[model samples]
Target: MLTTLTDYRLWALPRNYVKIADAMIQEILDSGAVFEDIADAPVEYVESRGDLDVIFHELRGTKGCNVQACYDPYIDPPAIFVHLSGNTGRDNFSVLHELAHHQQRVGDAWADVTEDITDRAFIKELREKVANSFASRLLLHEDLIDSAFGSGPVTAAGVRWLFDNSAASMQACLYRSLELEGNRVVMQADSDGRLFFSAANSDELFPPHKDKTQEEIARSFDRLQASADGSLVVRGGYGIQHLSGKSYTNVVLDMVLCDGCVLVIATKGRSEQFAFSDDGEYYQGSVCHDSFLIKDSPGRCSTCNEPKCSKCKSCGCPDKQPPPCTRCFMLLSVNDVRAGLTAHEYC
Candidate 1:
């Protein structure tokens, strides 16, 4: 079954990248600060605060330098700095990333205690990932993304709307959308077509980088980039062969360009297979045939007309013919896509 952000609970972030980010969000909520419309004004809380300092200046370095932001948490008054070389969207994300670091440092004294750790490289990378996750969440909160998708289909244009409104980079918006409510995979490659990072709800559904050489991965990347025309479905052995060991026969790839990286969101053609229900009950199949057998099950399985089934209720089944299930591809309405794209047109 596909897992949504809600499945992880309000502040329980399961991914390693967002573990500290979740804690930071919980701290904000616990402080009684109202963040009702954070997406529109992300810096509103910290901008007027006396303790946090934000700076922007010309940050130059050697050629091909990609350092656009930095955060200093050890100082008396925490500070965040962003390179003045990027666009508004990039600068927004940089500030939020540093703020994420500030939140972590304030919440725990031991957050910086890893200085003595031998793995400095690993620690640095982990901290960056956490900060990135923080920036994404701070701008595009779980509730906000959930509500956006509640009435529409998730598309590249929909993600663009999120980027336009929130203080997140286009890449961050795309990545977070992939993690929301679908069995999706987001593969990121450099301009040269070298695969650097891949995030997916299921490892089995995504192509495994561990088994492929850099050249092989590059070839697959090229194919995906060439075929991607906003949205495209790759079928049969042509596309499946590159995936090698994956069990899926086909994949729907949504490609978008952000900065210098190509972000591709891949959805498997086959439904997910699992043996458990949301209510902590063990099951053997995708749908419950006789939901009444389970204790404390909901009245009936809306998907299958079975009594006492909690899975159907958990998925919010509409009780339509061939009932709505997370295992299959969701039918997206064209109107929903258009509405989402033009959601902020008048604003």
Candidate 2:
């Protein structure tokens, strides 16, 4: 059931819960949780709740307590009853978002709303804003996402890192990741009603959802899902997208890398948002940069970072021999272990 913000237990909340919520917001902001740092957060589950579907206050005294907190403050606590129903859904960004609420002890009690909407309750909106910021940052911590973004192609592989870290939905993370790189990217979904997420500096990739008629979505969805690979390459629809390969393909969807144009649609695919891209542009990311995932792939002193360098005698990076770049040298010094080793899952 959808929860209305106004309807919740009021009298049973902790009298001081409001203050605790304030402190939590301040903490997250002081830590520099901004739009740029979306990928900085850790994505693991905090804990498990029981059969009691929703969690809130005592329903008697003041606005009650949060899921993981007592009347006492200081210890980090959650503000509401977070529904932990996501294992099959996208990466668990929702958990982190709710965690923000929990930490602030923001209760769902109606008293919070009737509390005069001024000082005490007045700051509620601001706190939620901070929690939202906290959640985004904690889930999409920029360093981690940037690391993966810089490391490899913004493909399913990198997304795995986001998933493991809890960066929320692939669409949001990819969009944010691209924004961090200063790229002009526009993302869209023409299925389940038309929806889109466009970069600030870029033009809209797809038309507004309202502008799309039912016929458009239905027809497009049909053409898109007919692929064996469960994906479709967009050729051009609203006269914006330019297809580099086939107009539409079941396996891969290629569009022109430009601003104000080019749209890729998932219509009906395993991945609602084409969050992972296998294009060459992704190879420029740090994850895939000059690194190949191969077991026993000998070291290469060559400037050309390639897998073939492993066996080639002319390669510059020799195994356990003198190093090439000072950076590479030191990296291999302690951890002579190579990329694609069975150690890491990507390997």
Candidate 3:
């Protein structure tokens, strides 16, 4: 039920998530069975836990269960514990994710077995990348994402479609889509006014290294989060936070909605610029940081920017566009279409 596994660079891994998801969806299409919004999708979700978590009730004893994709001990297939935690949180990605997992079960049984428990624990994380890849394509479907993203602006309503289908987080879905369209993205989080997740895009992985005076950063952050309300706001440390300046806003996060995706980097800071600067240069050491360019890569996008063959036409300056790159085009399309629909319906 457990095994030790080495971490592989996503680039070095033999499998390509983009391809795997496309093929998996083809398999479902080829199947004689009906593709109703059944329970086997790759990105299953629910409204109960506002936070995101993947489940594998069906993969426990399955063959490839020891493989990178089938690692969750939380749920076992065939007859899982609960009845339904299903809702379209990922919008366009959930069902596909779960379905792909089901597909993995068919081939994974005996594919490769692990000998330790940690690898098993890591399985949950592994499949997330896989299911994310699969669900994104299946729901977004290439042409649809491309056309939608290319035709107009990507909006929040577009985000709804992804949520409805995949059960993935709003940002995750956006990241996937924008990446398809040749943009890059990163994600971060906050914990006890310290650094947490630093999932940077392949391109801008350098700048955010600069550190503010850790003491001042912590105090400012603690002060802010304590008084944080509930809207996005710029803070002195780390990056940005959910609330503009509400209680508990001091230990803020770097929630930068740049390019087409979003990065929620969180940490503390003594001074605003010390903690975070939009500058691209790097200087200090471990006690310091990376260049601001690496930290804040998406200073390129603009609101109401049109969708050119490149990213947002309005920010039509970058010879390179931005993160959440073009490869993830489908999700962006879904983003745009959903936006228009929501606007038509609500706006």
Report lDDT (CA) for all predictions: 0.50, 0.35, 0.36
Candidate 1 per-residue C-alpha lDDT over 115-180 given as tens digits, one digit per residue, 9 for 90 to 100: 344545445555666667767777788666765565566654456456656667666786677556
Model 3 spans with C-alpha error above 4 angstroms: 1-15, 33-77, 80-87, 90-96, 108-128, 151-172, 186-203, 206-347
Q: What are the per-residue Cα lDDT tens digits for candidate 3 across 203-234?
A: 32221332211222344444444544312334
Descending-TM-score candidate ranking = 1, 3, 2
> How high a TM-score does candidate 2 get?
0.34
The alpha-carbon RMSD values of the candidates against the true structure, listed in the order shown, are 15.2, 19.7, 16.1
Which sections of candidate 1 miss by over 4 Å?
A: 1-19, 36-38, 60-67, 109-125, 151-157, 187-198, 205-230, 236-249, 255-263, 271-347
State the displacement of the C-alpha of residue 177, model 1, in Å, after optimal TM-score superposition.
2.3
Higher-lDDT candidate among 2 and 3?
Answer: 3
Q: Which pairs of residues clash in candidate 1, taking residues 3 or more apart in a chain or in different chains?
A: none
Return whichever of 2 and 3 wins on TM-score.
3
Q: Mind giving the per-residue lDDT tens digits that candidate 2 earns over 1-347?
A: 11233322221122223333344545545655443333333332233222112233334232222222222233344223333434322324444445555554544332343454444442554444344344444556557777666755454335445545553654445443443432233344445424344322211121223333222233455554554633444422322222221121112322211122223322212222233233421111112122222333453224544222223222222343322222211122212234423232322
Clashes of each: 0, 49, 114
